[model samples]
Target: MEESKPMLRLKRTLTKGNLWLYILSELKRGRVYAYGLSKKIEKEFGWSHGLITSYVVLYKLENEGLISSEFEGRRKYYKITKKGSEELRKAKRYLQQLLNKL
Candidate 1:
């Protein structure tokens, strides 16, 4: 019997490479609601993931303390926290260094 390699879909989905960076960039602009963020990402980068995915990422980021959110009517508005900004800076620098190596 042959052994099978484990699939790594979660890593790919979560990392999402530069798409995650772009999401951070958009969040840095100001507090944005989920639909707005999704639209911005789609318009700016042509990323067209489902609305649930955007909300899930936002939830994860907030849970990680990288971002903060407030309730507005029936919607939740999200903004980058200080820690999120710091992480964004670090990520940008890391990406730049990686690009330079390439």
Candidate 2:
């Protein structure tokens, strides 16, 4: 059995308006499997949910056309789409504005 880990999902670190931004940023690094993504999130962001939660976010992104996935061997790898990159740009702009305001 796998060991249990204490981590919160990406959503927990971001506002509802910015959840996808962080996810897309990670994807920008390269395609990643769900479990791999989750672990990276936990290490980098210091919070990540379980495997099921990670998959749920992946499915949502896939449905929204912000990301795509493919099966490679026994794992499914996910990558950001053009739309996702655009959204990431928007998020960066918004963050810049917010920082400037403060």
Candidate 3:
């Protein structure tokens, strides 16, 4: 029997750790919806995950006060909150420091 590698495990980890960062980055561009976020991630990362993942991340971020959302018709439009901006700044700083060490 052949062993199978767990596909998306690494991606899932990266997404879990960096999901907020990704959402913040997207919001920095402008207000966006879950579907838009999913498409952006797919285009930028080349992964084909569904919109639910993005919605879940957005929901968590909203609950954590990292982001805010408003209902526009049937869709929820999201924006990075002040806390989200700070989180993005911290993540960017950390990433920069790590890259500098490399």
Top-lDDT candidate index: 3
Poorest 10 consecutive residues by lDDT, candidate 1: 2-11
Residue 22, model 2: Cα distance from true site in angstroms: 2.5
Tens-digit lDDT string for candidate 3 (1-102): 643456456557667556777779889888888988878877876665656777788889999998899999998899998888998999999989988999
Pairs that clash in candidate 2: 8-48, 8-49
Residues 61-93, candidate 2: write the lDDT tens digits. 899999999999998899999998887888899
Q: Which regions of candidate 1 deviate over 4 angstroms?
A: 1-19
lDDT of 1: 0.78
What TM-score against the true fold does each predicted structure earn?
0.79, 0.78, 0.79
- The sequence of per-residue lDDT tens digits that candidate 1 reaches over residues 17-102 is 34556567899998899889888988877657777878777878889898889998998899998988999999889869988999
Candidate number that wins on TM-score, 2 or 3: 3
Off by over 4 Å in 2: 1-19
Displacement of residue 46 (Cα, Å) in model 3 is: 2.7
- Show pairs that collide, candidate 1: none
Prediction 2 global C-alpha lDDT: 0.77
Which model, 1 or 3, shows the larger lDDT? 3
